[model samples]
Target: MNSNVIPFDFDGQPVHFSLDGWLNATKIAARLGKEPTAWLRKIETLEYISFMAEALGFNSVPGTELEEIKALGTSAPGVKKRILELSKSTGMVRSRAGSSGGTWLHPKLAIVFARWLNTRFSVWCDLKIDSILHGEMSTRVQLDRACKALEDRKSQASQDGKGLSSWRWDRSSLEQSVGYWLGQVQMTLDLDAA
Candidate 1:
């Protein structure tokens, strides 16, 4: 394995973890407190199922085909069903003949799965996913700064006789300023901005 890759145990299943992160069906099942196969069967979308299958290295389709399928989005029920059938027939979710096969999921999907299973797990996964998507900055510091900035703006608006309730900062502006700081850190470290 490359030095950049790390190993993670999702419950009892060993995962080839990357900076981008992945979750396996076994782990999701564990987290959801459901049987793995049963849980997978219950998942509504073929795209989710297929993504998990591909991430686990089970899907036989070419990478380009997979990418194209992903680009098509998950709204078409017919397409999703057809893809799901093909994936299943091709043994997409099953591991090799003799091993404990499992499905692997991207961090985003993992977060979604967690959300579906448990609110607390969802919150935890959201924080982890946020750190992965956004660079790791001290959230407390950024939050404090944002809060202070908002307060100052509110104070100024009040002094000008603008009703405090109506004097609100746009959510996007706040996000941009905080995101700007995050971008600066990323630029300094030469990290990709998510």
Candidate 2:
């Protein structure tokens, strides 16, 4: 009942709309009782509905040409016309001219529109974040930063050796955790002996 909350029906249970994002359980649950074709369409329609709702709200989504109005500027006029018709058939409407020259929701269906819009936005953000943090670039960058920090710690360790015991100086947590100081000492001592 709260203005901030959006609720949806899930397997005969009323569930609160999540701001916490991208859970697969709802999708799985929604498909449980339907025929495969019906279930597939239901999930695809939800994704399509979400993208359509998001595009109307000044969002730049990677939807099909029909769902993304910005895509219309490049396509032929006849094709744009048909895409608009397809949008309306799928329960969306388009606007023309000035600041409001984009698609819009049927006034009677605003709540459904908003729920889908927020879900789409969240999903887009999640994809971007996942791409950044899960790639080879991210792995290389993180390891490079750690190695630089480790070198600085080794320099500090050599300076600390002038004072007395290895434990006396301020040490990196990694040195404490994995006995890096002792490993470095062993390497240095072996080199000196050779």
Candidate 3:
């Protein structure tokens, strides 16, 4: 839908709602020196919930990691119990094993939890304009620029027949350039996102 912007997509959609979006809220609170409760209104919202799912990469955390979560029969019970509760509430759990160890939530949802954990903006990024200086406006502007840069690169590559190498998230429309990718990295970082 974005004409002059690079649409962040997964599997071809027009959005990239990473877990970091919400999880990073905690960081926002930390920076604001607030109780971190005001922004919690989204705890029950789609944005918050979606962010959680995105944070947990594969949905359910690995059973192996669960044990380490709190040493099995110990203080971890509460966290484990909550995990189970959420499991029953949703089918987003993604479990794997061996080389693919560790529980993962979607990047977006994870961002919410991150706020719960850190409440620090250092985890997210602050490119083009610092969030402290520009807040949402500057960040949004930067995202727009990034998206446009990406789209322009994609169009040029397609015309150049650069071989259509896979870009982020299999986004064929994305331009191939290390700097572009680097900016993406910086963005994710600035957001203190996952």
**Model 3's lDDT to the true fold?**
0.38
Better of 1 and 3 by lDDT: 1
Off by over 4 Å in 3: 1-20, 24-134, 160-194
Error of 3 at 185 (Å): 11
Q: What local lDDT does model 3 show for residue 159?
A: 69
Deviation from native of the Cα of residue 175 in model 2, angstroms: 76
What is candidate 2's TM-score against the reference? 0.19
* Residue 131 local lDDT, model 1: 52
Which candidate model has the greater TM-score, 1 or 3?
A: 1
Over the stretch 1-194, how does candidate 3's per-residue lDDT look in tens digits?
Answer: 11221223222222222222212233233444543333222224323443455465434434454445435432443653554444424434233243322233333334444445454432442221233233344444555566676776566657655535543343643434434544655464342221
Give the whole-model CA lDDT for all candidates, comma-separated.
0.52, 0.38, 0.38
Residue 143 accuracy (lDDT) in model 2: 40
Which one wins on lDDT? 1
Residue-level lDDT of model 1, residues 71-92, one tens digit each, is 7655645555555554555354
Model 1: residue 160 alpha-carbon error in angstroms: 76
State the displacement of the C-alpha of residue 40, model 2, in Å, after optimal TM-score superposition: 17
